[model samples]
Target: MSNAPITEIDIAAFTADPYPDLARMRAAAPITYVPQLGATLLTRRDDIHVQEKRTDVFSSEQPDGLMTLLMGENMMRKDGVAHLAERRILFPAVSPRTVQEHWKPVFETAANRVLDRLAPRGGCDLVTDYAMPVSAEALKAITGLVRMTPAEMDGASQAMIDGCANYAGNADVTRRCHAATALIDHHIDLMLSDPPPRSALAVQMQGGLAMTSIRANIKLVISGGQNEPRDAIAGTIWALLSHPEQLELIRQGMASYADAFAEYARWVSPIGMSPRRVARRDTVGGVTFEPGDRVFLMFGSAGRDEAHFQAADRFDIRRDTQAAISFGAGPHFCAGAAASRCLIAEIALPLAFRRLKNLRLAGDAPFSGWAFRGPTSVPVAWSL
Candidate 1:
C-alpha cells in the first residue's frame, strides 16, 4: 500500500471522458487508492465484482448530494433482507413483459409522432429530436404525468438530469435537488389528480400509505421514470449511430435487435459506478479490508475487463453480455431495468431506424462521466 501511487481520480475528467484514465488504471492497478475522492478505486471485473458484493464494508451512501435526491432511499443505497420487501412492491413497476406491454402503445405513439415530423426532412438530431421525446413521453406516461406540456416535461427532466448527473458541490447540489424534487412533486400531483381508476399510485395513495413510504415510492418511480429514459435514449442513439452496419443488419431482419440493444447497454455501460457496503466482514481478491472502507466498484471499467469479455475494446452489439453490470448487481440491482429495456425497444429502436436511415457518425461525439456514460451531443446526418 505504501508503494502504491496515490492516483487522483478526477470526477471532472470522468465527467468529460474517462476511457483513457480508466484503461490506464485498469492496466496498472485494477485496485488502487485515489486521493481526489479519498477512496480506493476498483476497476477490474474481479475487483469490482467483489466490492459491489460487500454491502456492509463499502456502503451505498450516495456521496453526491444531487444523486441522493434522485435516489433518496432508492434501492441500491439500502441493504440486507429488509430492502427485499420494498423491492417486492417495485417489482410490478419494472417487470420486463409488463413494462413492454405497459408502454408499447405509448412508445409507438411517441416514436411515430417524432418520426413523422423528422422523416420528411430526411435527417435530424437523434438526441434532441428523436431520442429525447420518446423517452420523455414514456417516462411521463409511467409517472402518470399525462398531457404535460412538452416544455414543462423537458424543463423538469433536464433539471432532474442536471441535479443527478451534474455536481457543482454541496450548496449547488442542494438547490438543484429541490428543483428536481419540485419537478417530481409536480408529477406526483398529476398522478393524484387523475388517480387512473386503479393505477399504481392510486392504490398506494388509497392505502393511505405513510408519508415516508409515499414519498419514497413516489421518488423511486418518478425519478427512474425520468432519468433512466434519458440515458437509455441518448445511449441507444449513440450506439445505433456508432454501429450503422449493425443497425442496417437489424433493419434487414438479419439480426435480433433486442439482444443487440441489451449488449449495447452493456457496452455503453451507463450509471457510472455505484458502491455497496458490506453488512458482514469480508475478504476479496486476497486483499483484506476492514468494514466501513468505501471501495469504488467501477462498472464502467468492469464491462470492458478482459476477464469478463473478449476483445473488450470493441463496441460490437452482438456480444453475449450476460446480466451486465450496466444495470448493476446482486440484491441492489436496478428495479427499473426492465422498463429501461422496454423503453429502448419501443421508443429508441423505432425512432432510430424509422426516421433516420443512412445514420453515419459525424465526429468524436461529445460526452462526459465515466459512471454515467452517454453522448452529450452525438451529431449525425441522416436520410430516409
Candidate 2:
C-alpha cells in the first residue's frame, strides 16, 4: 500500500449529502482510503476517466465482492473477454436501435398510463405515484417479467440494490435480497417456459447463455435498470421544477429535455460510485494499490469536479456535460444507457411536463444515498 492519507467520513452524513465531503476529498488528495467504506476512493474526473479504462490493473471481477455475493457474478463484475462476451450478448436487448424500435413504444405507453392515472390527482408524490410505476412498468416489459406488478418490480429492485450495497453486512438486507432474487428466479423460470418474443430474457436465452448467467444478468438489469431510471425520472423533474430558469430554457426550446436529463444526471448522479477490485500491484495517480484492494470510482464526485466543470455544484441544463462520468467511463459502462435516455429524456420527462400542467413542487423533495442517489420522495402538484 502506498503512503496515502487515510480519510474518515461520517457514514450517515455522507449518505445524506456526499458532495461537500467529496469536494473536500478531491481538494486534499488524488486517492484516499476511507475506513468507513473500506475502499480507496478515486474522486477526480481525470483520474477516474483514465484509470477506469485500465482494466488490467483495476478489475471488476471480484469473486467475493458484495455485488457478486449478493446479486451473482454478472457482466458488470467481469473484465476483458468475459465482460465483453456477456455485454455482446446483452447488447441486442438494449442497443440504441432496439430501444428505439421496441422499447420506445413500451416506455411511451407506460409513461402515459402512469400519467393518465396521476394527472387527475392534481398532486401526488412523483416518486411513488409517478416515477416508480412508470419505471417499473417499462422495466417489466423490457426484462420480460410482465407477470410482476409495478410494486413487485420496484420492491425487488430496491431490495437487491440495498443488498448489493450492504457494506455494513446487514442481515436483514441480505435476507431481503435473497428473497427478492428468489422471486426473480421464479419469474425467470416462468418466462423461460413460455419465453416472450423480444424481451431481454428471451433474447439472452436465444443467445445460448447459461441459465445461471442469464438469471444473474437479468437480476443485474432489474437492480440498476429499474431504480436508476426511476431515480432519474423523478430527480430530473425535481431539478427542473426547482430551477425555473433552467426549465425556461427547455420551454423556450433553448435546451431539450435530453439536455436537462444529462445535466441532472451529472448534477445528482443516480448511480454514484462503482466498485472495483485491484487486480494486481499497480500505481494510479502516484498512489500504489496492492492486489485485492477495493476501489470506488466516485462518478458523483467526478461529475462535479471543479477542475472539469465550472460552477460544478450548480445545476445548469445549458452547460455541456460531456466530461461527466455518471454512466461510467470504462468497459463496464451502463448497458441500460440507451433505455434510460429514451425513458427519461424521450418519454418520461417530456410526457410528464406535457400531461401535468403547472407542475411544481408540492413540498420539500428530500434526496438520500451516496452509492445510489436520488430523491426519496418528490412531492409535486399539477393542474388537473
Candidate 3:
C-alpha cells in the first residue's frame, strides 16, 4: 500500500465511538493507514474538502468496491461525465423545486400521520415508531415502491447499508444484502411494468436510463434516503432531549429547526465515512497514494475537526455549520439533499415537537455504526 503511517483500531470500538480515535488520528497522523479497515483515512477537514473534489485522483468508480459489488454500480460509483449524466437524469425527482412544490406536502403528511399514531402511545422507540415510518413512507413515495411496507423499506435500506460497509467480509451481511437487493429488483420490475407518473423510478425510466442503472440508482436512493433521515430525525430528537439548553434555543425562537438539523448532522453525522479507490499515484496531505489503494474520506471526523469548528465535539445548535460535509463535497454529493432537508428540518423535527407535548427521553438511545452512524434506538416519551 501507500507509505502512510500505520495505525490499529478495534473495529467494534470504532463503530461504537469513532470520534476519539479519529481526533487522535487528526492530531497525529492526518493521513494514516488503518490495518483493520484496509484503507488510508483522511481525518482532517481541509484535506477531505480539498481531496474529495479531486475525483481525477481519488475516484469513486470502484467497480470491485464493496458498494458496487453489493449494491451494483450506481451513479455514486461513477465519475466525470458518466456521473453527471445519471445525476441529471435523477435530478427531477429531487430537485429543489420538485422537493418544495411536490414532495414537501407528501413528507409533511407522512410525518404528521406517524405522529398521529404515536401521539397516544405516551412513549415509544422514536427510531422505529416515528423516524423509521416517516422516512420509509417518504422513500416509498419517492422511489415508487408503494407496494412495500415501511418495515420492508427500512429493512432493505439497513441491510444494504450494512452490506456496503461490510469491509471485514461478513458472509451473513452479504447474504442479507443480496436478499434485500433481490426483493428491490422484484419491486422495480413491478413498477417498471407500470411506472408511476412522478416517482423517481418513473422519471428515470422516462429519461431513458438502462434497467440495470435504474435499479442500481433507486437502490442507492433507498439505502441512503431511508436510513440517513431516519437516523437524523431520531438522532436530532435525541440530541435535543439530551441537551435541553440547545432545544431551548430553538423553543425560544432564537434558533430555527433548520439550525438544529444542521448542527445535529454535523455533530452526529449519520452517514459518516465514504470510500474511494485511488485512480492514480498522487500525494495528498503529505502522504503518497498508489493506484488501486482504498481511501476513506472521513466525513464524520471532518465535521468535528478542531481546525474547522470551535469546541467541535459538543452539540451546539447555534454554532455555524457551513463547513459541515455531512451531505458530501464531490461529484457524488447526495442528490437527495433537498428531500432530506425538507423531511428533517421542515416536517419531521418541527412537527414532532409541536404535536408531542412534554417530549422527553424514556431510556438510553444508543447510536451505532462508523460507516453509517445514527441512533439505533431512541426511547422517548411524550404527553398523550
Candidate 4:
C-alpha cells in the first residue's frame, strides 16, 4: 500500500517481462489495484501469506473469473467446507505416496522415451520436444486415460492451458480451450464407462462421486497436472542454462537436484499469479478492501520479494526456500506438488543434464504468459 493513488500498466507487456516491473511494484507499493485488469495485485510475501491463510476473508469461490472460466466451478473455485470435501475426495490420487509409487515410473519411462528420440538430434526446442511430452504422459498415466501420442497431448494440453493463460477471456482462447476440453471430456467419459484399475479415475468411480463433480475435478487435474510441470521443468532448465555455475554445481553433485528444483520454483515460479476473491471487507498493509473485489495473489513477485529473500532477484540454488510459496500455502496448497517435484528431480532435469552432455542454449529464450509463466521456447544443443 502507498499514499499515492494506484498505478496501472499494460497487461501484455507486463506479462511478457514482469520481473523489473514486479521489483519496482514490490518496493513502491506491495498492494495496489490495476485498473487495466480490474484486479488488485498483492506482491509482498508476508502480505500474501496472511491473505492466503484467511480464506474467510479472501475466498477462492470466484465464479465469473479466470478459475471458473478454465476448469468450470470445481473445487478450485469453492471455499470453506465445500472446498475441503472436494479436495479430500480428490486427494488420494495425488497423495505423495500415490504419486511416488504409481506415477514416478510413468514419468521416468516417458522422459527416457522422449530423450531416446531427441538426444540424437544434437539440438532441439526442449519446451516442445521434452518438457511438454513428459508432463503430458505423466498426467495420462495418472488419470488412466488411453494412450495418446505426445503431439496430441501437447496440442490438447496447450490449448486448455492457453485458455487458462489468456485469463481475460479472449474469444479465440475460449474457442480453442473448449475444443481441447472436449478431448478431456471424452477421456473422462471413457474412464467412467470402464475405470482403470487403481488409477485416480478408478478412485473417483469407486467413491461413487457424481458424474458432473467428477468431470469438473478431472478437468481441474488435467489443467493443473498437465500444465504446471511442463512450464516448471522448462523454466528450471532455462534457469539452469542461464546460470551455468549453479548448473555445474548440480551436475557435479555438489548441490542436489531437489534443492535446485526448489530454488527454481522460487526463482522462476511457473504459475505467476493465482486468483482469489475478497470475501469480506478487510484492511491489510494499510490498504482497505471491499468485499467482492478481485485479488491476484502474485506468487511470482513473492518469490522475488526482497523482504523475504536475500538477493531475491538472483537465481541461487543454495538459497533456503522454507518460505517459498511456489506450490502455494495454506488450505489451497497444490496437491500435485510432490508429483511435480518427483518428475523434475527424478526424471526431467537429470535426464536433460546427463544424456545431453555439455548441453548449452542454442538461442535467446524469452518467457511470457502472466497466468502460467515459463520459457516460451528453450532451444539447446548438445555434443554430437
Candidate 5:
C-alpha cells in the first residue's frame, strides 16, 4: 500500500493563526508531509525533539543544498565534526560565563540607553523603538562591528529574517534578502579593514580561525543575536500586558520577572520552527521517511503541545518552562541563548517595565511571520 497523498493547508491563514491548524495536526497527523511545502511538519514536542536529537538521520548538512542558499555556509549548515569545530570557535564569546561577565553589562548599558529615549516619550512602539534598538546595540557591542550603527544592523537583520519567513519562493523577499546579504557583507568587509579595538571577530582572528569561517559564523551570530532577543523581549512584554493578573503577580512580588521571561519563551517562542533534513531513510512517529526529505521542527506548536504542557494555550508566568524548545535542542541549540535570556530576563524587560510604569497596551496588535513570530509593533502607553 502507498502512503496517503500529502495534505495541503492554507499557508497565509497558518501564518496568521497557526494554533488552530497546528492543534489539529498535533492531534492527528503530527508527522506527515504537506504537498505545498514539500516537507513533513512535526508539531508535537516529542516528534520535534526526536528529529532534532538525531542529526545522524535528520541532518542539518543536507545534500539538497537549500540552507546554503538561505543561511550561507554557517554552523547551522554543518553537522557532526564540522559542526563541533565551528561551535568551539564561536562558543567562547557566547558562553554562559561570557554572557554573565561580558555581555550582561553591555546588554544593561544598551537597554538603559534605549530606555532613556523611550522613558521620556511616555509611550512608544516597544518592538521598534525599544526592543529592536536594545537588541541592535547589544549585538553591536558583542560583535564589535565598528562601521555600522544599531539601526543599520536592525534593518539588515530584519531583511534576513523576513527572507527566511518567505523562504517558500517570494520574489520580493528573495530580493530583499539578497540585498541585505550584500549590505551585511559590505559591512563585514569594512569591519575587516578597520577592525574594532576588541570584539568577538578580533578574538576569532587571534585564535587562528579561518577568514571564511569567521565571516559565515559572524553573520550567523549577527542574524541570531539581533533577531531572537528583539522578539523575545517584545513577546515577554506582550505576554505580561495581555495577562494583567500575571503582571500583577510580578508587581506584587508574588512571581519573579525572570520566570515570566522563561514562560514567554515556552508560550510564545519568538522563533517558532527550525528545519532539518532527512540524511538517510528513517522512521519516526509511526511514519517512514526516505532520504532528502525536509522536516521542520515546529517549536511554536511544540511549545503549546497539550501533552507536554498543562493548559498549554494559557500564558502563565508560574508555569514550569525549563522544557521549552525556544532556543531549540541537541547540537543545534542556540549558541546565543544565554545572552538572549540575560538581555530579556535581567536587562531589557525589567528596565522597560520599571521605566514605563503602569504600561498598558494601546490596543490589539497582531503578530506575523510563521518562521519567527512576535509582536510587530507593541503599542504601549504609560504615565511619565
Candidate 6:
C-alpha cells in the first residue's frame, strides 16, 4: 500500500546490478515516488513509454539543480531543432544501410584482430582487450577521426568513466571532468585543424558544421561509445555464463544469434536510467511536480516489469522483445544505437564464443558504480 520506493536501496548497487530492486519497484506501485530523490520513479513499461514519448510534456532537459553538478550537459539535454541538428550529423553511422555496410566490417576487423592477439594465449580482460576496442574502432572509423589511437580514445573515455563511477560532487570529480573534456576537446580540435580526405570526421567538418558543435557531438559519441560497450559486453558475457543453455542455443543458431546482441542489450539495459525535465505543470502517481521537475527514467526497472514481459527478470536471449526502450524512445533516443549493437554482433559476442570456452562468473560479481549498471569487472576463464 505504500507508494514509496525503497530509497535506502543502494542505487549504486542497483546501477551495479538492479534486477533485484527492479522486482520490488514493479510490484509496489509500478509508478512509485522516491521521497529521498524528490522525483517519482516510473517502472512499468507503459508508463515509461508514455512518459518518454511525450517529449513536449516531459522535456529532454533534466531539472538541472543537482545533476548539472555531476554529469555535464551535451546532446542528452537538447530538444527540438538543437537535438535534430546534432542527431543528423551523427545519425549516418547508425543508419540502416551504413550499419549494414560499414559497422559489420569494423566489428569483424576489430574482433578478429584482438582475438588473434589474445586467443592463442588463452584469456585476456575482455573489457579492455575485445569489448572496448571493437566499439572504439568502429566509432573512430565511422567518425573519420584523424588521430587514430586507442590510448587517446581510451584516455578520454576512461576519464569520464572514472569521473562517473566516482562522482561525489567533489574536487576530484571536477578535476577528472575538466581533464576528460579538455583531452577530447583538444583532440577534436587537432583533427579539425588538419582535415583529411575520406575520413568520417573530416567529412563532417567539411559539411559546414562548426568545430564547437563537432567538439560537443564527437565528445558525446566517443564517451557514450566507450561507456556502453564495457558494461554491455560484460553483461552479454555475464548473461551467457548465467544461462549456459542460452549460450549454447546461441552457438548452434549463429545466424539468428546475430540479433541476439540486441536482446542482450534489452535484457542488460546497460545505461541504467536517463534524466528528464517535467515540461509544464503536471502530476504523477498523485504527486504534483511543477513545470520543471527532474525525473530519472528507470529503464532498468521497466525492463523487468512483469506486466510488460513474461518472466521479466530472466535474461533470455531468445525473448520475444519488440524494441525495448533500452536505447530509449521518442526523438532523443540514442543516435548510435545501431552502431552500438553492430559492435556487439560483429565483434564482442563472436570473439567471446570463439575464444572463451565455458565462461563463468569469476568469484563474487563486482558491481559497477554510478549511473550505469553491470559488473565493474567480470572475470571468466577457459582452457587454452
Model 2 Cα shift for residue 291 (angstroms): 0.5
Q: Candidate 1 lDDT, tens digit per residue, 1-384?
A: 212345676677766877667788888876666766555677887666655665556666544444555645654455666466566655654567666766666777877887778777755565666677777776666655665655566656555555554434456655766776676666677567566532346555665555456555656565555545666676666776676777777778776567677776666676667644434455554455555555567888887877778888777767788846777676677777777777686556765766566666666667666645666665667765
Tens-digit lDDT string for candidate 2 (323-342): 99889888988998999999
Model 4 TM-score is 0.95
Pairwise lDDT winner, candidates 1 and 6: 6
Local accuracy of candidate 5 as per-residue lDDT tens digits, 1-384: 114235578988978877887888888787767776667888898878767889988888854454467557888889989888878877777789888998888788878878887787878888888889899888887787756787888888887887766657889887887887787778777777656534668667766778777776777778788877888888789888989999999889899878998888787777888887777877776778777777788899989999979999899998888778878878899988888878888898889888888899887778876677888888889998
Comparison by TM-score, 2 against 6, better one? 2
lDDT of each: 0.64, 0.91, 0.92, 0.81, 0.80, 0.66
> Which prediction has more favorable TM-score, 1 or 3?
3
RMSD of 3: 0.8
Off by over 4 Å in 2: none
Better of 4 and 6 by TM-score: 4
- All candidates' TM-scores? 0.85, 0.98, 0.99, 0.95, 0.95, 0.87
Candidate 3 lDDT over residue span 110-136, tens digit each? 888898888989999999999999999
Candidate 4: where is the Cα deviation over 4 Å?
1-4, 165-167
Number of clashing residue pairs in every model? Answer: 16, 0, 0, 0, 0, 4
Better of 1 and 3 by lDDT: 3
Enumerate residue pairs that collide in model 3: none
- Runs in model 3 with CA error above 4 Å? none
- Ten-residue stretch with the least lDDT total in model 3: 189-198
The true-versus-predicted C-alpha distance at residue 116 of model 3, in Å, is: 1.7
Q: Give the TM-score of candidate 2.
A: 0.98
Question: Could you give candidate 6's per-residue lDDT for residues 1-384 as a string of tens digits?
Answer: 234344446655655566776677777655665654456667777778888877776787653533333345555667888778766765655676777775677668777787777667655565666666766776677666646577667667766755644424567765876687787666666676665443446655666666666665666666677768766876677677777788778668743455566677666677767767777776666646566665667877766667657877677777777747887877877877777776776667767777676555655446564246665666666667
- Which candidate wins on lDDT? 3
Ranking by TM-score: 3, 2, 5, 4, 6, 1
lDDT of residue 200 for candidate 5: 68
RMSD of each: 3.4, 0.9, 0.8, 2.0, 2.0, 3.4
